[model samples]
Target: MTTTPALLPPDIRVFERGWLSSNNVLCLGEQATVIDTGHVKHASETAHRVGAALRGQPLADIAHTHLHSDHCGGTAALQAAHPDARVWVPEPSLPHVQAWDEDRLTFGDTAQRCARFNAQHALVPGQSVRLGARDWQIHAAPGHDALAVLLFEPEHGLLISGDALWEHGVGVIFPQIDGSDDFDTFNDTLALIERLDPRVVIPGHGTPFGRADGGIEAAMARSRARIEQFKAQPAQHALYAAKVLIKYQMLDVEAMPHAEFQRWLDGTRTLHQLHQLHRPDLDWPAWLALVLAPLFGKGVLRRDETLVLDGA
Candidate 1:
């Protein structure tokens, strides 16, 4: 958790994490709470980071913005670190979470990893949750993931927007994979953010921004263009999703030998799905090389004969 202290409330700090994990928001007050603990691989680091940031203040609560692997991967570690702290997750997925149903929870089918964790409470939309000594209105944001929520504080004009609205654009419209056609909902969620008119935005992935209105506008433009492109060619979106998932895995490992990397990349069911959806004619290696060309071309990754390194 890299400390980002300026342009935010003294009580609220954004722990900027690498791309593989979501940024954690640490809220300090009479009852201290940390929102969104990054990817599972970094669970121990995240727990230690929270401990160092707490400065002996007992953590009283842990909450999630969503249940994506990157968003809630450190839940178990944090719970272990502060056993007395209550855990709250998005309400829609609580049943699946309680049962640890990997498919419904999106770990199995996606080949993503999330350490099992328990949720004692629910973060229901339309409710005001008290965290970091401020009342946050929990608004249902159903674009990135159906159960995702956005938190806003009217008094401070601060918004804790999850993946639904990033500074650059929204995340993949994952519901489309199930043929749910959630692009409209994603657009609606963007409209909701625009309406919030937040002065500052602490997004799920990047650093907090002060002039969020302009960010919102820029994000909306990108969202609309991407959605139109995705709508026109759904298979392209699937290929993009495959790349993102692959990149996320690469981030988790940092670097991997070619043989192990190929095995891991081939292991993802989502990537296989994309292969079947878009390029059944090409073999896995050929298909992967084609899809990964963009990443390599952009210098975000480096591929050699023996190993692959995440350059970005």
Candidate 2:
């Protein structure tokens, strides 16, 4: 069933966004806070929307479920807009963020962009934080991003599931793609969500969905099936990831010249690693072509005589 804003607590507002950015969760209280700002390209819009939603409530804090570029890219803009707002990031990410290590943070590796921002606090798993009038329990949610966390409010059975859980599927297993044994960790995260038994889930993307009456079960089943396939044939997962990255880049701009697209594909270190690990025989250009053919055939992307465009 569809979940509407009215279904959420009166003080909470969710701004569902497109693929380029993650959904923004605004928790209003004596200390107004916003969780998971969108990508940098949409930073201004994100700031404007958040400002309007606040209705003049001084933004006391900004929080992140994880520091993926899409999830935290607008942070710098938000901080500028609300100078008094304190930023809170995951405890494990605190060091990298403080040092501004884009490599360790995965921004450079993924060829994604996030303007530098600072954090004044960290969200530790198993701890609790108050947002609006409720206390949220923080739980470690790795696999999608090794440092990710999910927030749960027992009083309302509401879960703020970042990329760990979505309506159709989970986020790409970056740890696995990056040469870590994290498929099991991803499953463990799904199991943890099952034990929580939330009544509703505010996922990082798409509309929030009810977990009661088979919604959560169905989503889990689909996610498990997808992960199992990846486990059985990891090369397939690598190919899938390549397409996702390409589409994500396309979403950031109206169009790109073929040469620029090739350069981007060349520079994305993660893609190169995936290529080396999964299809070394084909070479980079051939591998890229193989990955792009399906995206073009499905109309997920289109190419003119000189430029590539986002098809949908």
Candidate 3:
């Protein structure tokens, strides 16, 4: 595994990994806390690394910005290793954690994506928690997920923004993609983050970045541009869907046959494109024509008068 350099001052350490996992932060003080553990696949390694960083300081708490599998996957392992550690999670997600809903939590489908963890305390917005000697403020950030929240240290001007914000974009505006997302809610949440005016941001997935030198503004601009582009072209949504599937499946496009690809799409919600385009009444041929025609014309998919993998 490639190692990410320590980005924060001596007090804070970051364990940066790839997309399947989030960067973990170790906040050292009288009471040490870890923010957002990596996915379950990497939980053991993450714990080891975090243990080394603690250097005998008890890991007093394990906190999460949201309930996403990747962000809290390692919580169980870390807590198990450090039996005295208290696990903190957003108040809205507390019920989900208590019930441990495998299906509702989407854990059954993404087991490889996250590790299981137990919640010991609920962290609410406007609430304050003492980490070391400093008090960190919790703010509700509900765009990425309705339960998502962020951490802000007013004195340090540092923000631990989970999937709510990223260097290039935000988390999959899940509600939008799932056809149940509320754009208005997402916009309101974005505005809330903008108002925070954080000097430094430690996102859920990327390297720690500064608000200075136009970093935050640039990221916000990129997010706005993506929102506009997505609104203009619905197919961009499908493209992202495919990208996510590829990442989740870890499939090599070159090795997949056209028939297999079609089966995969059929089994997944991609088949719902017919409903999305308001052509639900169309027959299979008509639906295939409606769906594949534009993609072929756009050179995204190639068909030699037969459903063969492009370039095959």
**Each model's C-alpha lDDT?**
0.84, 0.88, 0.70
Alpha carbon lDDT at 129, candidate 1: 89
Weakest lDDT window of 10 consecutive positions for candidate 1: 211-220
Q: Name the weakest run of 10 consecutive residues (lDDT summed) in model 3.
A: 246-255
Writing each residue's lDDT as its tens digit, candidate 1 over 1-312 gives: 465556677889888886788999988998898999999998998999899989988899899988889999998999998999988888988899999999888788677889999988899899988887888899998877888899998888888988887777558777776656557888788788889888788889987776634765676688788888877887888788888888887787789998888778777777787787668899988998889999989987898888899877
Between the candidate structures 2 and 3, which one is better when assessed by lDDT? Answer: 2
What's the distance in Å from true for residue 81, model 2?
Answer: 1.1
TM-score, model 2 to reference: 0.95
**Candidate 3 positional error at 1, Å:** 8.9
| Candidate 3: pairs in clash | 40-115, 73-115, 175-181, 176-181
Which candidate should be chosen as best, given lDDT against the real structure? 2
Which number leads on TM-score?
2
Clashes of 1: 0
* Best-first order by lDDT: 2, 1, 3
Clashing residue pairs, backbone N/CA/C < 3 A, model 2: none
| TM-score: model 3 vs. ground truth | 0.79
For model 2, residues 32-93, the per-residue Cα lDDT tens digits are 88999999999999999999988888899899999999999899999999998999899989
